[model samples]
Target: MTAPEDLALYVHWPFCVSKCPYCDFNSHVRAEVDQAAWRDALLADLRHEVALLPGRRLRSVFFGGGTPSLMPPATVAAVLDAAVAAWTPAGDLEVTLEANPSSVEAARFADLARVGVNRVSLGMQSLDDDALRFLGRAHDAREGLAALDVAQRVFPRVSFDLIYALPGQAMRAWKAELARALAFGTEHLSLYQLTIEPGTRFATEAAAGRIVIPDGDTAADLFELTRAMTAAAGLPAYETSNHARPGAESRHNLAYWRYRDYAGIGPGAHGRRGRLATTRRRKPENWLTAVSRNGHGIEREDPLDPHTRAVEALLMGLRLTEGIDLDRIARLAGGEAPVDSRAVALLERQGLLARNGAHLRVTDAGALLLDGILGAVVRAQTAVAV
Candidate 1:
C-alpha cells in the first residue's frame, strides 16, 4: 500500500507552437508568450499548493503541456528548486518533461537535463512522414527520429509515443513501425489508438465522413499485435496504452492510477488531493491573472464523496495489468465492498476477471471491453448494496 505522505506534482505548460488536429487538451497556440510572467505565476501557484498539502514526500514531478519543451530551462529549474524547498523529495525522485520531436525543442534537451529533468517523454506521434503530416506534427519522420536520438542521448530515461490504428493505416505498416520503435531500445513506449475526440478537428472530420479509422475487429487485431510485439521486446503493457520493461513504468502516472494524492499547478491541470479534485483556470491569460490575484489559479475545487472516489480509483486501477487491491477499494468506499462478490465470481466464471486473494484483475479479453465490464460490476454491487 502507498503511504499517504507520498505525493506527486504535475506542472502544466499550456502554450504550443501548433495544436494537433486530434487533441482536445487545454492547449493553445500563441504568437508571443511572456515567459517571465508565466515563470512567476507558476512558482506562486506551486507555493500555494505546497501550503495546502504540507510535509509530503514528492515521489515525482511531471512537466506536461501543450508543449513543455517550449518552456525555458530556467523556468523548469525554478519550479524544481521550489518543489525541493517545499517538500522532501524521494531518493529516486523521477522528474519527467514532455517534449516534441521538433529540432528547436531537441536542441534544449541537454539544458533540460542539466536542470534535473531525468526523463523525457517525446511526442513522436508517428515515424512515417505521411502519418506525421496527417497528425499535424511539425517534424518530419527524419526530424522526429533525430530528436528522439538527441533525447536518448541526453536523458537517463526516454519514452516516445506513437498513435496507431489511424485512418487507412495497414496492419503490416503498423507492425513495421512498432518494430522500428522497439529497435531504438528505449525503456518505455506509449502506443495509443487514434480516437476522434469530440470537439476536435478529427471529430469534425469523422462526423462529416472525411475520415475513417479501422473497424472494431481490425483495431482489436492491431491492439493484440501491439501487445504481442511489445511483450516480445521485454516491454510488456503495464497500463492499457503504456508499455515498459520491468521496473520502468512511469512513476508519476502510476501515482495517479493508484489513486494517490498529487498537486496540480498551472493552466488547465487537474489533480486529486485526498478527497478533493482540483482544476486550474483553462486559459493562459486567465490563469495568470488568477495567480496574480489569489496566489493560485485554481478555478474549481470540489470534494469527492467516498463512493465517487472509490469508483474513480477502481476505474483507474483496473487499467493496469497488475489490477487493483480490493481491500484498498473497500477502504475508499468507507469499509463497504467496492464490487459485488457475486459479480466477481460470475466474471471469474466467464473468464473475464480473476482474483488472486484480495487483488482483483481484469483478464486480457475483459480489458478490451473494460467500460462495459466495469459498469456491469459496479451496477451489480450498487444494486445489491442499496
Candidate 2:
C-alpha cells in the first residue's frame, strides 16, 4: 500500500515587481524591501511552527507568490534547509515554486534547482501578444518562450498557465494555443478562463463597460472544448482548472483537494491542519507580529465540522477524473457515506453521475454543473444527517 500522505508546507513570498490588474492574490509592490529581515522572520516562524508539530513527513512544499521566483537563491536555500531540519521529507517530496516567464527570473532557475525546486509553474497567462497586452503581462511571447526553453533545460518538470475565453475568444483560437503549449512537451498545463473577480480592476472596468467578456453559453462551450482537446492529448483535467498527464498531477494541490494537513507560513497564507483552518495576517508587518503570538495569526482560524469536511471532500474529489471513495468519505466524515437518493437519482438520470459499486463519480456533464450538483446533494445529505 502507498504510505500515508499527511503533511505539506507552504511558504508565501508576498512581494511582486508589480501586481496584475486581475490578480487578487496577497501580493504587494514596494520601492525597496528589507530582504534580510523578511527572510529571518520567515525562518523564525517556520521554526516556531515546527516546534508545534515535529517530525511529520512532508509530502510537498509549495512556494506560492506574488512571485517566489524573485526571491534571492540564498533565501530559498535557507528555507529548504530549515524545512528539512524540521520535518522528514517524503522519499520523493514534490517541491514547487511559482514563476513568471521573464529572463531575469529564469537566470536564477539553475540555483533554485540546486536548492531542490524540482517543478516550475510559470505564469504565461496568455500567449497571444494582443491578449498579453490586454492583461498587462510583463513578458512578451518571445521572451516567455525563451524562458520556457531555459526552464525545460533546468527543471525535470515544467508547467505553464494560459487564460482563455477572453472577450472575443473563439474555440479555434484556444485549440491552437493548447496545441502549441502541448508541443513544448510540458507534463502539466493550467488552462484557466478569465474571471472578473470582485475588487479587481477588471471587475471595475467591466462594470463600467470598458471591458466585455464572452457570453455565458460561449464560455461554457470553451470549457467543454478544453476538456475534449486535453483528453485527446492525454493531458486530462485533474482539477477544475488544471490539466496534467498521468503521474504529472500536482502533489501539493492534491494534498489540499484530498483534505490532508499542511502548514502555511508567511503573510496572507492559508492552511488547514487537524480540523483547524488558519489564515495568516494579510499584511507583511501584521503577519510578523502574529507569528510572535504562539505561532498563529491574528486574522482568522476556523475549525471545520465533520459535515463540512464531507462536503469539502466531495467538492474537491469530484473534480478529479477519479471520483470519491465511499469508504474514505465515511472515514473523514465520521459516518457512512450519506449519498442523497433524490439528488443522486436526478443526476444519474440526467447522465451526470456514475456509480461504480460503492463509489459515486461525477460525469462530464456533472462536472459542468459541479457547484449546483454538489449543493443539492450536500443540502439533502446535510439535512438527513442532521
Candidate 3:
C-alpha cells in the first residue's frame, strides 16, 4: 500500500523549440518567453501546493515538458531549491529531467546536473535517419547519438526513448536498431509503438490515406520481439513500455503507476492528493494570468468518490508487473474491489490473468490484450462484492 504522505512532484515546462507531428502534449512554441516571470510563477504555484500539503516527504521530482531542456538552468535550480525547502526529501531522492537529444540542450547537461538533476530521459525517438526525418525530429541520428553520449557522461543515471513500428519499417531493420540501442549501456529504456493520435499532423495524414502503420498481427509480433530482445539484454520491461535493469526503473514514473500521491504544477499539470484531483489552466497566457490574479494557476480541484478512486487505482496499478492487492483496493473503494470476479475467473482460464488470494496480475500473453481485459473486468458498480 502507498503511504499518503509520500509524494512525487511533476513540473511542466510548456515551451518547446518545435512540435512534432505525432505530439499532442501540452507543449507550445513561442518567439520569446519571459524567463524571470515564468520562474516566479512556477515558484508561486509550488508554494500554493506546499501550503496545502504540509509535512509530507518528497520521493521524487520529475521535470517534464514541451521540452524542459529549453528552460534556463537557473529556473530549474530555483524550483528544486524550493521543493527541498518545502518537504522532507528522501535519502535517494530521484530528480529526473526529460530532454530532447539536441546539441544545444546537451551542452547544458552538466549545469543541469549541478542543480539536483541526477537522471535524464533523452528523446531520441529513432536512431534511423529516415525514420527520424519521417518523425519530424529536429536532430539527425548523428546529433542524437552525440547528445546521448553527453547525457551518459553528465548524469549518473540515464535513459533514452525510441519509437518503433513506423510505417514501412522492416522487422529485421528494427531488430538491428534495437540491438544497437541495448549496446548503448544505458540502464533504462522507454520504447513506444508509433500511434496516430487525433488532432495531430499524423492523424490528418492518416485520414487522407497518406500514412499507414503495421497491422495488428505485425504490431503484436514487433512488441514480442522487442520484449524478448530487451530481456535478453538484461533490461526487461517493468511496465508496458518502459524497461530498466534491476533497481534502475524510473522512480518518478513508478510513483504514478503505483497510484501514489503527487503534486503537479505549471500549465496543464494534473495532481492527485488523497481524494482530490487538481488541474492547472492549460493555456500559457491563461495560466500566467490566473497566477497573477489568484496567486495560483489551478483551474479545478474536484473531489473523487471512493468508488472512483478505487477504479483509478486499479486502472493504474494493474499496468505494473507487481499487481495491486484486491484488499487494499477494496479499502480504497470503501467496499469490495471494483472488478468482475466472473470475468477474472474467465480470463484466468484463458491464460490472460492470474489471481492468487488478493493478488491479481495480467500474464505476458494477456499484456497484449490489456485494454480489452480491463474493459471486460472492471465492474460497473462497486457497492457489492462479486
Which is better, 2 or 3, measured by TM-score? Answer: 3
Angstrom error of the Cα, residue 62, model 3: value is 0.4
* Off by more than 4 A, model 1: 1-4, 380-386
Best by TM-score: 3
Give residue 130's lDDT in candidate 1 (0 to 100).
94
Candidate 2 per-residue C-alpha lDDT over 1-386 given as tens digits, one digit per residue, 9 for 90 to 100: 55544688999999888878889899988788788877888888787667766668888999998999999888988998899878888889898999999999999999999999999999999889998988888889999999999999999989999999998888899889888888888999999889998888899999999989888789889999999888889998988888999999999999888778888888988877678777888998788777666555537779888777777787778777688887787776777555576888888899888877768888888777777877766644545344
* Model 3 CA deviation exceeding 4 Å by range: 1-4, 382-386
lDDT by residue for model 1 (1-386), tens = 56539999999999899999999998999999988999999999999999989989999999999999999999999999999889999999999999999899999999999999999999998999999989998999999999999998999999999999998899999999999999999999999999989999999999999999999999999999999999999999989999999999999999999999999999999999898999999999999999999999999999997888888888899889999998898788876656777878898999989899889999888778777878767733454242
Task: Give all TM-scores, in the order shown.
Answer: 0.97, 0.95, 0.98
Clashing pairs in 1: none
Ranking by TM-score: 3, 1, 2
Total colliding residue pairs, candidate 1: 0
Native-to-model Cα distance after best TM-score fit, residue 26 in candidate 2, in Å: 1.0
The best candidate by lDDT is: 3
Q: In angstroms, how far off is 286's CA in candidate 2?
A: 1.4
lDDT ranking, best first: 3, 1, 2
